[model samples]
Target chain A: MSKQKTEHRKMLNATQGLKNVMGRHFLAIEQAYRDGKPTAWATSGSPVELLYAMDIQPILPENSATISAAQKYSRDFIEIAEAEGFSYDLCSYFKTNVGAVISNADLTKGGTGKPTFMLSTDVICDTHVNWFEVQAERLKVPHYTLDIPHVVSNTNNRQYNYFKKYIAEQLYSFLDFIQEVTGNEYNEERAKQVTQNSWDLSMVWQDIYELRKAVPCPMSTRDTFGGLFPLFTMPGLKEPIKLYKRMYREAKTRVDNGIGALEKEEFRLMFEGIPFWYNLKFFGMLERWNSIIVYEPYTYAFSKYMNPKVTKEMVLSQPIEAMSELMLSFWYIYDLKTRIKKFEETVREWKIDGVLLHENLSCRPNSCGLYDLKRHLMDDYDIPCLVISSDMNDPRKMNETQVINQIESFIEILRKRKKK
Target chain B: MQKIGIFDSGVETPEEIVMAAGFTPYRFFGDPTLQPDRANEHIPPTHCIWTRNLLEQAIKGLDENIVGIIGTHGCDRTNREFDIWIECLNLDFMFFLNSPRKRDNLALNFFINDLKELILRLEEVFNIEITPGKLKDAIIITNKIRKLLKDISDYRKKLVLKGSEFHELVKNAQYQDKNQVLENLEKKSEELKSRAPFSEKNIKKILLTGSEIDDTEFIKYLESLGFHIVIDDLGVGTKYFWNLVDENLEPIEALAKYHLTKPINSIKYPSYERFNVLQKLIEDYKVDGVINIAQKFCEPVLYDHPYLNKKFKELEIPYLFIEATYNRESYNQLSTRFSAFAEII
Candidate 1:
């Protein structure tokens, strides 16, 4: 057999704008650091709108970890953190950030500069609050943790109301903390506008996702991985809205032209965990087997709002309440039945033929239900499913050759099933 | 009485509520002896062995008397494991209580609301109403057990109880009927108070902290090495019986306040209080060193190690970190490490 190199497929044209978005984001943080502006390192799922309204520049170390992993610098950073008594069993993203922070790595290599304060929420996972606490202590910065209750099931009205009220109260406390830290007045109109902007951006993101349901998916997981970046890091800003609007148009154009991410989209796969950041080319390698990952809960999570009917009135008049909803709206935090239903719906809607479940060792919450999820989908739909075990950011755990073999076998199985 | 299996480390499960609902609150620590072959198929091997062992036990039908399971949102593993059990097992009753990580009034209120929801579910499923009066009675019984356990734990400061013996008592307390456990604990506490304290001049005092440690053998081994366990912050240890429920308050509200204000595990936020609590214990017990023992792949405790290490360093306290699976594959290595840690302290 002749040797063949994996081809790197180009992502959506609008993704070009992401470079500028990322540049401006890091630059703003740099300026904040240099100019001694009020800044806080916030978790990706935190209420960045509140931070933005308070004129506190929110730096996302999670996003920085992602950037470091993509740059193949996470391994060294992770080792540095591991040497600092952080167990290798912990989250790779967190370790990478800790490593970068400890080593004082440069911006290009994912060093999140010290901030005046730190903020995190346990809305997504239990790891967030503790992880941020570690950094806050290390950096000698005061940290605030927002306790957002998990929405196990939305059907329980009284229970959900309590959860909402609890979260709203926490958000109010969060505002007080920010004000106390920054000595800045709470700008109600700016908070409202920021919330509105995030909502509008999420709506456009939802539209972009809808366009992915096209027979030949206009956008692939590889693109959405990058596309979801600004949405996470700069959610309350207008930049994401502009970028996502352009992405919607580009994806719409692709769908209109019947252009898929691949030359031949033979199989559509749904990925169930975070992508392997160090080897994103693995997504491209799947194209060699005539497969395109059109759906991933991990990617869509940035745009998946549990409460879509959050009104403008609610956003304006009750900004904290609206922020509470946004914080509680993460899909992964919901119950198993609801998440399974959404998974099945996406499989049918996106025409997914196979599922790639990455049992990421670092993220217990995301990886825990995946085995059962795979079983349910396969049992119900008779679809092919393959589980890849590795860490999302830690390259040490991934065996490229073994993963290739597994993918080849899974692709063969999918091909045979399709032939039937 | 029938049993309601509790899957948390027992901090947020509120065994009193289970007793109020007319069931034994059987705290399910994954069997250390059992190999979780089936659970490995469901969750990856990277998951903590305690959760995997619990799932394996449930899958194998090892405990048929468990009428239901009360899983709490204490950690990510327990939270998701609750979801997994709901999907994979056919239980008569399953409740995932959303215990808050933060200790605030809102969390207290939310926890009360959640406990009430749990009470309603338990009532509907088991055909039993958990009246506040019944709950208050359960609190008294549990509070008595807590007092007895606290008395026994205090004796450890005097070296009156072996670490292994205390671990056994705590472990057995979660499995047996609350009334029976209370009886046993009362007798044990009396025996401990009457017994002569251990008088070893060279015994090194050590504080234990981290994940739910079910391995009594490990504790026994540590004690055998001439190190006295002064206090523990483990979920199955002090965190289980640290705080007394305010019997003066409403039953559910008291339960909520008790669990929230207790010495929280590594998963809870505002970890300074937890550290401070441990520090206070260290000072009170005159602990020579600290040993944080976490189950391999346990996230919460492992995440807290760096911070804990920093605190220990600042106080010029010697600290040793150990990550062990349920299986004992490295006893010799651990003994060597512990011996070295002991000598330095």
Candidate 2:
């Protein structure tokens, strides 16, 4: 087991290096997409394209937020927002967006320019619609929310009608607002092309994840997380497709060669929480400890991971579900329990000995029911579990000593089990 | 319609809530120093001890009488908690207050209005009518108690009564009848220390905040660590008691006054006056550390933790965010952090 673990670590490290190179490529693509000021309007899959049509630099608030919690941000922003009266805990991303972007009038210093508008593609949580709506009211900043369909039964009609009646018309209004703000005409053809491109990449990323299911996984979660950068930083585009294909090919070669990504693969760990910010070197934990963490929650969020085998015609037929199903849309159907069950299955199939759940304080989605997950892991698999409480990004919010203490104790528990 | 139970610590519980619904307003005023050793075994030591105490009371059936609980995002720890806890323990709960940022007066005004909206929302959720008459009656009950405590405090200053008399008077004010407030102060136990009169034991005149150092060991730890620990304003210290009104003023106005008069210590104290009062205490008593002990997820402090850190940093005074959980296992580390800090005091 130890030798196999070493092999897994070696494989994950190499895969990580490849992903880092791929990340650089994705950044280059983002650089191309960058306009003046690097200012981004944080759109909640609710109605993001308005900013794109408006020429407002689009930055994923979830990206900054997760990274911020990983960085250990100015404490949990959701708490601050909740105290400010948005009391619903239905969506953490919404709470965070409001906390970090809207309420944090000082956020301008962090960015090159002011985030003029926040768009929401209200698909996952209904609370998000109210959240973005209320923020727009409070800040008096224009907020555009495109109601995406919630996939309760994999049916699109109810979702499509809901989109038309409550969301699509509002989306059109948002585009008009963008036109007024940026003076850029809405380019329908370009938008459709990017949408199609993103839809294709989604399928591709999903396929890559499926291939990674092989024992001594030819790819590492670290690689998948890193390589999915384009999807997050610049989703619905060409660069991500190119990047995923390259990584897929690289991993396929390793599998074909019958060489492990690591010379030895021992314990497999499944990671939760927005990846650690400063110590993004979180992957390094497995590297140093002779283990491999095979899957990450957020990386699978990309087009390819969630919507694999997506055909161009399939996406063209239902553009909204094509893009939204996995991102904004899927969360409702798969829900928290489904995701956890899937994570548990993945861990068992990967033959994981332990799980390192980062109980990120700020990420409501990740934090919700973590204690419950810890209980489940113990009762079901009798697997040793360690939960590190942390903020995803804001470095100021990280409690180094507390976290280090938890890690030491958790490791001790698992190690003690081995000695027995 | 079911009545919603609105409970808060210290004098922060509004006087008008009962009047709005015409139900008995149940208060949960606990002794700040009423040691809770049992809870220490269950929760982490770095979390809010006050909230831990509350949870202890709740889980232990001490607060089973209350129908529901309303919490605020005053700290990150408290903010993220409650829901998980209540579900696990099976208590009905909801979040009703907004975060208060007092940098701007308009923001503050907006904040008060937000609270007003929260009160109404609570009414709607609980299915009760908040009549003006009930508010006025509730105000009277709270005001009468506040005045009595003020009188006890004044008497203690003049040597007309001992400080223990006042502690006894204030500690049981929520449950005891108003006539008892004066009687409790008058019939205080004679546990006076002659070697060091009440003045000599001036309690190092410090403001102590930590996750439920309600355990005497934590208090004894602070004392053994060298600084005298005085007011527990933030945790299970002074803020755990609810005030009774005078049975006089308008209910809403009385509610406003109760929130206003609550001795403020950063966690949504009615006004900035609490900050001023805290500064005055630090200046007058030659106080040392503003140790903020927050339970993990005591939402109020998590929101206020950064600001308090900033203020203490700017003042160049000793302030520690002793974010311990229910039961802290790291005494060596805490001892090292505090002993070094105690040297400055």
Candidate 3:
């Protein structure tokens, strides 16, 4: 009898599982919408455990916009938003999300569904507040904003303490808002469980990323970028945990089997900022050149949970403070020094051969520091870095051939450096 | 003595403290002539042109005289500019004041704490003690300047002053010494009030809003096109001068309250406050149209545009939105649009 094909026989088995996880996640959201359950449009760094505990489905427009851009369907939605006076230079995710909402485009059929209310945090980017404001206006729903101040100094600074206090207060207020909107009592147990689940998933996700540091890194940027959907969409759920477990196992196996993401693995690269979601196939093209992007700071930044010691008991005891710390761990909340330290650590650990920084047109907070970061990485760490100008979703802002040429030239330089 | 530079939008800078700290408080305005090539090298091209221009000015405009620069967190672009300047500039001191967007007890507490931190840092950096008496004296001088500015703006609404002249007065106030600015405004106000109220039969009164409007040429162009900018909600215009710190309260807390209660801008939340302010301006000025002069790639202003458009439509107000840069070449299209808007109203 022929030997049965094992599930992990193919390199893409874990990635395929991630896709299924995302599919089911979206289907559940769609089912929730169909069932007349109130859903919310939440910022990626917003306190989502509250929504999950309240049984309110949280749909992240950023994630959905990424999906739309990946599917090459964001242009029409963006144009619609522009027609409504949204600037093309604004965050493309905003344009795509607002455009999709105004046009009544079934984003879930494509990626997400219309939100009944909007909840956003002011932690990651100023764009989140403005984007959700426009979305709430367009959808004619109530909008809630959680102001999470950036920690300007070390974790122990007075500013950080005040920020924690402010965020905790806001988180409690947010819970009250959720309760009022959903007409449901606050579920302390459920919220704790959700936070605990988030902590579990974060550990597994970090474990998977740590596995990529192995010689001949086991995962590709494309796989990790695609795998981020479940984490972004359903972080406090079993689906993402299961998906991450599978990913971790596959990466571990790849390390043990001495298999690299690329056939020859000539160069290991670190990609900064968001990729051009419209053309993820470009990542696959890099493999042909024997270069693999083993490190993407955005994935690691988003997947990192603040405290590993967080237990269900701790979460139940102080859900607001717990949620505040969780949201505060968002990479954008860090000051320049801490942020730079994190980047340097990632580069050292991943043994990054070169850095490709995307000067994303739509994202200011993420892209604004690329030039400064590139300068530091080059001058201080002696790491070669390149800044590629592109948009997160808008194809018009990118020249495909030029991007390819830049990447090829970068890869050639990396190869020459390695030879030296 | 070397001058301490401050961005025009540094409303919470406690300029008096800087003055007491033995440095001249020089408010840096955007030079329309400065090329943003150097800034573009540091910041992304998609950032606000106004901010890029400011960075260019910081890099080249104040070469030797600036001892330190105090930046504020008015918007994302401003925050990034502060980061770049702190990292790149070889200055004696550079500080960023992270002001909260909301106006609440917590926000005020944060603002006061930040202000106190700024004071302590200034004392440490410059080796100058900031006493309450010195702060009070500085507040008095700044308040006089603000009062004069308010007079000039109020005169503009009453048709006693031309829009270009009012902008020039405000621009001078931004750059000149507080005493010198007050003297000029006092003299200009007397001359303007003595003259006959200027009126044209068909000219439209337009209320300008959005980011900074420092282009004197653009103001002249609008006036030439038979439009009077009766009022504005710009960061560097009326919004900068209309609010004054309370003298009775502790100076630091008063400054915090002043910033928290300042006219709403696009960066702040519950943006209805901005709409309310704009509506009041429109009504007070009896404006014929509203002109939103936004810098391209300015997220805050761009985000507020759609809602403002809807609000204007609901209120039956004619609205003209124009995206601009700090270049003269870009004004032709703006001039044409303004002229068309003028005709329509």
- Top candidate, metric DockQ: 1
Off by over 4 Å in 3: A1-11, A34-36, A109-114, A151-156, A306-319, A326-329, A332-334, B8-12, B19-22, B61-65, B199-201
> Which residue runs of candidate 2 sit more than 4 Å off their true CA positions?
A1-38, A41-50, A59-207, A249-260, A274-290, A301-351, A359-372, A388-420, B1-49, B70-79, B91-345
Q: How accurate locally is residue B275 in candidate 1, as Cα lDDT from 0 to 100? A: 79
Chain B vs. true chain B: TM-score for each candidate?
0.96, 0.58, 0.95
- In terms of lDDT, the best-performing candidate is 1
How many clashes in each structure?
Answer: 0, 112, 3
* lDDT digits (tens) for residues A1-420 of candidate 3: 223332233244767787678778778788888899989988887777778888898888899888778777799889988999888788888888877776666655244555778898777788898887876765678988977665442223655567677777777777788788878777878877887787788779889888889988888875788777766778679888887888788778889999776557888888888888888888878877888888887777667464554455666678777667666666654556666777788889988899999888888887776788888888998888988988889988998899899988988888888889
Window of ten residues with lowest summed lDDT in model 2 chain B: B188-197
My TM-score estimates for the predictions, one after another, are 0.95, 0.52, 0.94
Best by TM-score: 1
Which run of 10 residues does model 2 chain A get worst, by summed lDDT? A105-114
Off by over 4 Å in 1: A1-9, A153-155, A304-306, A311-313, B199-201, B329-333
lDDT of 1 by residue, B1-345 (tens): 678888775467788888888888888776667899999878888888888988898888847788898888767666667777876678878888888888888788888889888988889888888898999999999889888888889878888887889888888887899888988988887777679988777888889988888878888889889888878987667877878899999888888888888876677778656778888888888889999888888887888777788888999989998987787666656788888888898
DockQ of each: 0.66, 0.03, 0.54
lDDT minimum window of 10 residues, candidate 3 chain A: A1-10
Error of 3 at B105 (Å): 2.7
Which CAPRI quality tier does the interface of model 1 achieve? medium
Interface RMSD of each: 1.9, 12.7, 2.3
